[model samples]
Target: MSILAIKHGIWKVAGEEVRQVKQVTLDSEFELEEIIQSNPAILQDNWLIIGRQVMTVYNTYIDLLAIDNNGSIIIIELKKHKTNREVVAQGLDYASWVKTLSPSQISTIYDDYVSRYYENQNTLEEEYYEKFRIQLEEESINNSHQIVIVASEMDSSTERIVEYLSDSLIPINVIFFTVFEENSTKFISRAWMIDPQETLENATNSVRDKEPWNGEYYVSFGDENNRSWIDALKYGFISGGGGEWYSRTLNQLSVGDRVWVNIPKVGYVGVGTVADTAKKADEVFFNDIDGEKKSIYKLSKNAKYHEEYLEDGINAEYIVKVNWLKAMTENNAASEIGFFGNQNTVCKPRASKWVHTVNRLKEIWQIK
Candidate 1:
């Protein structure tokens, strides 16, 4: 809670010799809002700012409106240092209005926000996929929402109300941002009242009413600048690369695990059983069209998997061999409303939508 520093390798904590940083007050709540608007990542990553001073049907305006990768609307309200319980009540008021918004209305709100702020930006759907690396399903948009009350600090009453609401399965929270001045330089740090990931999980589960995971994994086959989905279909494998975060999830697959692969912005293209655990790109060999065994690096010139980081342990591509039960080209990929999606390369989706997606895919692919 306190930012302290040592000068000349000598610690000072007593009397006039103590070195302390001055915590300063922000010029205005608008100044805090400007900092957040310019960089939404300061609040959270994978969020797209949809509106500023967003108006409600009740003739009130929300401080900032955003949408996360999961398509849940994020209502960010701002206040100066030490906010009161009224802000909590106000946040609930705004959420009540946000909960009833239809998909078209959400799109229109984004359009207005763009027209007023960003002159050179894509439409809602285009920007959503670009930011999240997954297509936006209209039916899933705004199915749930979160309220974030940000201030320099929260008073006891406000914190208590937020905790109660969050504990009751309401996706609401408070964030504290403190500004400090040290030797003519200003720095800002942030903290949350509750663990964000815990809040998100509780919110998602409560709103989605997801069923138990059925032991199947969801794979996002991001066949873009680095890898090729065509090569994957031909080679009997799935992959991820460019960074550890991208490739590490493939390690979750083991021999005999079932996986359903979805190509980002495309559709569900394959369902298969894992034939092997993950291996590095150059280490994975497949029999080519010539019936000659060759490394993936050699067989698929177009993919050039992790060419930039072939030998780099952290960034190199990783592959998991699969035996397809049924697979299709991108042109024949199956897509429909309400299918489960995630940015992770592999996840055990427990949402009801995932169950529906698998059942429908079984019928479409005639896979029994």
Candidate 2:
């Protein structure tokens, strides 16, 4: 319904306007390590790692033992000052040992921890946090022990160990974060995500085929039944919550707002809020970006994404602004760029003519 109502994909209505967004947060030379250290997203309770000195022999006692928010224990082997390649091998050894813990054994470890681990030991004990951890782990892993590694870096020898262990076809993940100083700024940051599969997919898709607008861009919305299709789109495009989750929140939402929903099957959906009804229609107009004189051209009733009449040149009056507008930066990867602006919708190019019209045609996406 909305696809046909506002501007088409790439084009929008001219006289319609938006308030000029104040460039309030001027970009500054800040330390990335500090920024990473302060990132709220990474410090989630569900994925926090906890443990102490888990041993895998071979002159390697794990530096720390901790469960990720996911309830799997991470065998952390830290290297101070400079590290050797064998540290990675040690991590793999710990990973193997962690994979052998039984349900009862894992719970026992957590039981011994709750009262001794934190500042408010009573709080966790009272809440039966150990029981909760056990329950969560039970629900998460099926039969095998969940294992992972946490280190600042991987040496070639350890990298080789990881390769060997991984080649055995086990469901294990490796996480490495580095603490470094750049431009007089110290940063404690994860080198990147544990998975490289998605990054490779993104690179293949985003080459030369960039978004038309300099704003934000999103991927296609997904349905429960059509998971793989949705996943592929997300991997292939800069998509977030651009579908049902966004549409459902319209009653409580406005233009220029953003939301993130991590679908278990599809990863993350970054939806920018737009119009919800006839009341919002008046508010969803485009203010002139340039202060030049403007003219309005009424378009014919061809219900396409951008406009079917690019054959007629820039003849259309205005374009529709949807969940588009990606940042113009070096690499253009979402994880590799600076973020600013309303999570609200963007009018960006979709098809060839830059139609911002997203082809999200799920019935759940329709507003009442």
Candidate that would win on TM-score: 1
Candidate 1 accuracy as TM-score:
0.67
For each candidate in the order shown, give its overall lDDT on alpha carbons. 0.81, 0.34
- Compared with the true structure, what per-residue lDDT tens digits does model 2 show for residues 178-240? 444434544444433233222212212222444443332333333232122232222221222
Which residue segments of model 2 deviate by more than 4 Å? 1-46, 55-60, 68-71, 80-83, 122-176, 180-185, 193-368
Point out the worst 10-residue segment of candidate 1 by lDDT.
1-10
Candidate 1: tens digits of C-alpha lDDT, residues 180-233: 777677777788888665466445654547678788888988887678889889
- Cα-based lDDT at residue 295, candidate 2: 18
Best by lDDT, which number? 1
lDDT of 2 at 202: 23
